[model samples]
Target: MAGSRTKGSDTLRAAQMYYLQDLTMDAIARELRVSRSTVSRLLSTARETGLVQVQIRSPMDSAPELERAIRAKYRVDVHVVPVADSVNEVEVMERVCLQAARTIGPLVDSNAIIGVAWGATISAVSRHLTRKITHGSVIVQLNGAGNTQTTGITYASEIMRRFGNAYGARVEQFPVPAFFDQAETKKLMWRERSVLRILGLQERMTMAIFGVGSVDADVPSHVYSGGYLDEVDIDSLAASAVVGDVATVFFRADGSDAGIVLNERSSGPELALLRGVRRRICVVSGESKLNGLRGALAAGLATDLILDEATARSLVESDGAAEDAVGGFLPLDTASGR
Candidate 1:
């Protein structure tokens, strides 16, 4: 026990020198009369033992012009991840998701209810979440994952589980189809006691996290490829001039869901419900999703956005004549108001 205490003391000292004093590993090794490799191990042990915590602030402030432009134009807070022009879309997505995970970790707290919409971007973000322990917090699925070919429980549950595990929160799964065959079926299911429980939880959500789904993404969105939609559904969306979706709810390029037809059967929360959540974090990446992102922003679905620099540049550079003509987001009844 004496030896163990001494070793822990040495590890903490090494971490302080290396992180705070900015001393090199060799310097730390010499001071402690240990080999350089041992010093490295000590530093690693410090981090593993939680004796040292590292935080990387986003570089969004570095590009003040870009960040300001996005905030001014979109009316949402933006975290613009810096990605090189050389990086592929996949790499860009990885970096942006990492930033998003870090950003979300501190915002959650005990007794907070978080709503999560499952998808490619969100799944990736889930993989990168920084563990944050909380009590009485609930991570609820914002949409169902069932489809004709598969239940989609394994895929969607895994994502929710990751978030729940990371936050030390309870998981609430929405067990239903992503899109029902008939809108009437959804209407009927919404009235069920089991479904109403989840809906009631949703109305109490304090924060919501989601990714915009786009058919044209460089990396395909899960909703478009996950067997959730059939040929008829695809044809309907295309005919309706739908650009993309927030969760499973489809919307047109002008951010209007008025005649989208498909949204009537979607299990995802309505845009109004989502907007009512105190904090809405929308994570989107890749240039292919620009149209979808534009529509989502136009709808005022997001209170904050996490996106890559290139995509942000493209978005702000555009004239946005169509979205402007559509004017601002239409007012809708809130969960309680409705």
Candidate 2:
């Protein structure tokens, strides 16, 4: 019994130095005063005998209950960012973005194709991405940015550029209009060979990152306030009972996004197409996005969500969430002008 216990202690020390301290096999052998072959056997035996343990724990600050509740309520993965009660709303948003980047960075791989949609929340998250060297990965724009008032390229391009730079991925831009005046014009343009190439890349996307565009979010969705929509557009959306949009494709409170007249002219991919993506990460900030987030979830748009704790609690604790099994439709006040 004494000899067996001494062997176990030796195994642990060898693992600590060889694995934990980044020591080479030869170096470990020298420190342990054993042959290199012996060190190899010990390391192998340590793992095989269950003497070396490895665990991946949740973040210390994670809200496991909120994560559990949101997962139970929505049936999707939830990452709740830790935002102190003292931090301002903007800082809260930035922290959410940081966590989102951290979550997404590991999922990227060499030669993977990712689709990205530009918006305030997504833009914020993109800028803080974890630097990586994922060669052959392509980041394709999911929607056009150009509007009548301004060329949308500068803003959206900057956002895409930041993502590309961080991941060392190639970028494919969509330089078409955000919304065409006539639906026929969009249909005609989409068939062009040059446009088809970008569309093809969009089709092959393995992962997509976007924000649920809310008309009432604390950080007002850029597409709504970015001169992409006119008074008539706003009026039409409201009259049609539209709640919010994802990638400029508007959906209702009940998650119906198809056959809407405004959708025909929008350049964003339809919700049906987005549903097919393997990993769809939706990063949201303020509680004012409750309706929009609910709408996206109703359509089965997001596979992962990262947001602040207050918003997560509000979502999981809202009224009628259990009955419908759709979303948390609580009323929240969101300030603007960031």
Q: Number of the top candidate by TM-score?
A: 1
Clashes of each: 0, 0
lDDT of each: 0.86, 0.82
RMSD of each candidate relative to the true structure:
5.7, 9.6
In model 2, which residue pairs have backbone atoms overlapping below 3 Å?
none
Tens digit of per-residue lDDT, candidate 2, span 1-338: 32344555667778999888999989887877777887788787666444453334466644788888778756689888767778877888898987788778767888988999999999999877756667799999999999999889999999999889988999999999889999999999999999999999988889999999988877789998898989998888988888888999999876786567889999999888898999999998888888888778777788999888888878876634554674443322111100
**TM-score of each candidate structure, all chains considered together:** 0.80, 0.79
Pairs in steric clash, model 1: none
Ten-residue region with minimum lDDT total, candidate 1: 329-338
Error of 1 at 250 (Å): 1.2
